[model samples]
Target: MDFSFGPEDERFRAQARAWLAAHLVGPYAGLKGRGGPGSEHEGAEDRRGWERELGADGWIGLGWDRAHGGYGNRGATLTQQVVWAEEYARAQAPGRVGHIGENLLAPTLLAYGSPAQRDRFLPPIARGEELWCQGYSEPEAGSDLAGIRTAATLDAGDSGYRITGQKIWTSLAHEADWCFVLARTEAGSRRHHGLSFLLVPMDQPGRIEVRPIRQLSGTSEFNEVFFDGAAARAEHVVGGAGGGWQVAMGLLALERGVSTLVQQIGFASELGEVVRVALRTGAADEPTVRDRLVRQWAELQSMRWNALRTLGAQSGTGGQGRPGGADPGAASVAKLLWGGWHQRLGELAMQVRGAPAAVGPYDWSADRPYELDALQRLFLFTRADTIYGGSDEIQRTIIAERVLGLPKGARPST
Candidate 1:
């Protein structure tokens, strides 16, 4: 359990910091601290450009190995990857539009995808030429993901699959170049069985439609994507055709990798802001506010250590399966820890402002709609923290059955 970073890691950190300082300038200079969590709608075009800047500098896939028919990723160690995440967060770099590809999709491909799939997809993601979105959650399947009803039929004519289904709460689907979708490929198959993970192109004019879902936060980062006979090349299938359940599960585990560390760092920044606000507004004089702030800081520190302890274990296997950590349920544990912690921080952000928190700074121009301030948006968005990303209930069930060896919960008839 060594938590310390050596001089080499520090050198990598310095390199990352210097690169960010050099590039986050002029047009991009105003983008610092703009896009994150609830604020994904802000500076999106600028952030996409920033993604290209990151890719050009070899910062996109630090952990991807060039040895496995991969492209020129930095091949950096897990510690160095964490160093990069930390530096990126501390610099308040734009919330990465490419994170789904660079962190989740890339790793999943290395572990399960064919070499051809890797060659086709990895390079664009590394170059930031393409962006991706996950098509896992459907209207009926969200937390009970095995219940997905989306179906993909193989088309013998064009030698591809014709997929027809709807995906809801799809983050950034409106702007994505492609979508990795989980759909039923076997007619009689039920639940997680007979499912295929299909790579769907988003540009099909008549077949695919992206409708933005407005949130209480007044942002439409989430979307509902309809695939009415959307086309997917048969070659684009990863982990082969009936193997999507495994691939999708593995990607879920990877969701808790270095990005968790990055997210925790962002949580720290949010907490700091709340503390400063409390002090400025004299809310710190209240014993309850002071206690809550101190507790949040302590919990955040604990989360950092847990993430570091699990980083090596997860990295060994590309964060797939029950990644080898002190606790086999570390991924679930991490999700539970942060999801609730972040939601609380958002509540605190609003609480510190008292009456002013209810109101917000808005641009009520004749052309644009009203907007919520950062803290107001934070409160609104975190309301869904426990519900999205597999949900708190789902995380707990994973721990109960997988980690604690409890009897499986009942499932409705498929």
Candidate 2:
């Protein structure tokens, strides 16, 4: 892949950088570098408003086609999207509140949704007026999605389906306006069969409830969502009933799209801070610590190039013209690469801090029993990096069975 950006791409980068500088002001200025992974609970309403500010400038759906209410005509190339992500991170802008909707659901809808569904759902998301949370994992179905037991029955009036089940580890569920749920719609259907992807409104009175789960970092960005006969309109179903497996898989592929690149940029920032800490604390004087830091820098660069290569291949396939959709191997490899790297980076972060890492927040009041610094939060939160999303084991299995055509592993009885 060509590493050089054309003149037009450079101009786009300049425009993106300028816009971020101009708009990240006042209340938004303090938001820079806030609201990431473990710190998602910080200034959420402020971040939501920033999301709308981005939408107002037509910066929300950079990769979606114009026909789908995006900026495709003005050359929303993969390169340009990458440029925007880089600039966004460079500015230390607030983490996006609508990312789950903009990156995952909108693309999947474009690929598998009915015209009416797209017409109804795409506009609000494009304008950043709504936020979305994923409802794929349940108590029994974290990595093994086929084991999900969330069930939905068709309503008596046939206008929609009534969903009843529990979803755990639901990120941003407390703040989302909608949730895309995968529920079993066929009685007695097992595994991946009988599933439907239903878009559910989150504000239902007696039907939906969200309870935040406190993490080790003392934040409640993750939640447990209960659906007691929650209703999804008949037209709100994506990819038809009993056909949600494919649509859900497509959305998983999109989960590894351009956003991964943006995540790496954030990781780069975090790593830079670690390096500064190491230097300030004389950890860099240690040969092993210095070597590990150098290796991390090199590996991050390699990951960036690999992402560009994979996204370029996807674009060439005329698919959604984004990353990971065309190549499942690329998606799995990317996950495996970053998951372990992040976990290791977290370890390195603690190591560089030495004994200071072991201490908790100074405020131990009853109201604030526990608190964590940024590095402490990164260390604690990234321990789940290898577990959430898809897990290291699942990624390796995908590469082994799906990509390499290896024999299937034996399944344990539930």
Candidate 3:
């Protein structure tokens, strides 16, 4: 594939850069590079306003069809999307607060939702008026999604369902207005069967609870959400009841969409910061540290190219329109590549920081006992990169079975 950007793409990039510069001012000026992976607790309300700012300017939902409140059909080409992502990261804009709604939920609704459902959900998301969270992983499930025990029973007197279970590691659940849940609808059903994709509101008292999970990085962006008979309308079910496995899998595919490019851009920024610190601290003068930095730069370039190739493959196969049709193994491969790369980057970050990496703000009288610097936080957070989304073992198994046509691994007896 030709990697050169044409005049149109360059123009788009300039426009994106200019918009970010102009809008990232006033109250938002201080937020530049403030809210990211381990620092999600910073400037959250302001970040939500920034999300609306993007929506008002038609920057959100660039990949969805115009009919669905997006820019246009095949909304923005792969190149244009990449340009925006790169520019956004370069501008050091605040991390998006509505990413779950914009990237994951909106696309899933476009793919598998009814017209009414689309009309209801897409507009709020497009306007950045609401936020969403994933309800896939449970305390007992995590990466083993097939083991999710969150169940929803049909209400006898109403056209809704009552959800009752616990969801752990629910990122931004406290801020989300809704949750797209994968819950068992059919009784006595096991594994992937009998599951339904239900859209549940989070505001109902006596039904839903969101208890923030404080992390080692001193953030509560992740939460433990409890549903004690939380309710969702029947029409809110995407891809029909008992069809959640397919819908959930489709959403997971969307998780590896153009957003992966955006993520890499952020990764590049973090890597750049590490290099700058190393140079200032004389860590770069050391042969080993310098060698690692060079390798990281090279690996980042390779990751960008791989992302472009994956995007091209999706566009060629009409996977842009049918998100569920994208290559499954490609998603696993991307996950494995970036997950390991990020974890290593974290290690390198600490090495560059040297002895100071061990020190953090420690005050017994303060509300928080400790405060970590950016590098220390990065180290602690990325430790879970390979574990949270999908473990290295799971990704390897996926590539082995799905991509290589290898024999399936033996399942443990329940």
Query: Which portions of model 1 show Cα errors greater than 4 Å?
Result: 317-328, 362-370
lDDT of each: 0.88, 0.88, 0.87
User: Cα deviation of 165 in candidate 2 (Å)?
Assistant: 0.5
Q: Which ten residues in a row have the lowest lDDT in candidate 1?
A: 317-326
Candidate order by decreasing lDDT: 2, 1, 3
User: How accurate locally is residue 227 in candidate 1, as Cα lDDT from 0 to 100?
Assistant: 90
Clash pairs for candidate 3: none
lDDT by residue (75-170, candidate 1, tens digit) is 888888888888888888889999999888888888888889998999999999899999999998899999999999998774999999999999
Per-candidate clashes, comma-separated: 0, 0, 0
Tens digit of lDDT per residue, candidate 3, span 1-414?
Answer: 875888989989998899999999999999999889999889989988988898888888877767554433236767888888889988999999899998898878877888889889887887788999999899888887888899999998758999999999999898889999999999988888899999999999889999999887778879999999999999999999999999998888878888899899999989989999999999999999999999988988888888888778777644436664656698888898899899999999999888888887788676666778888889999989999987888889988998899999876432
TM-score list, all predictions? 0.96, 0.96, 0.95
Q: Look at candidate 1 and tell me the lDDT of residue 165.
A: 90
Candidate 2 Cα errors over 4 Å, as ranges: 67-75, 317-325, 364-370, 412-414
2 versus 3: better TM-score goes to: 2
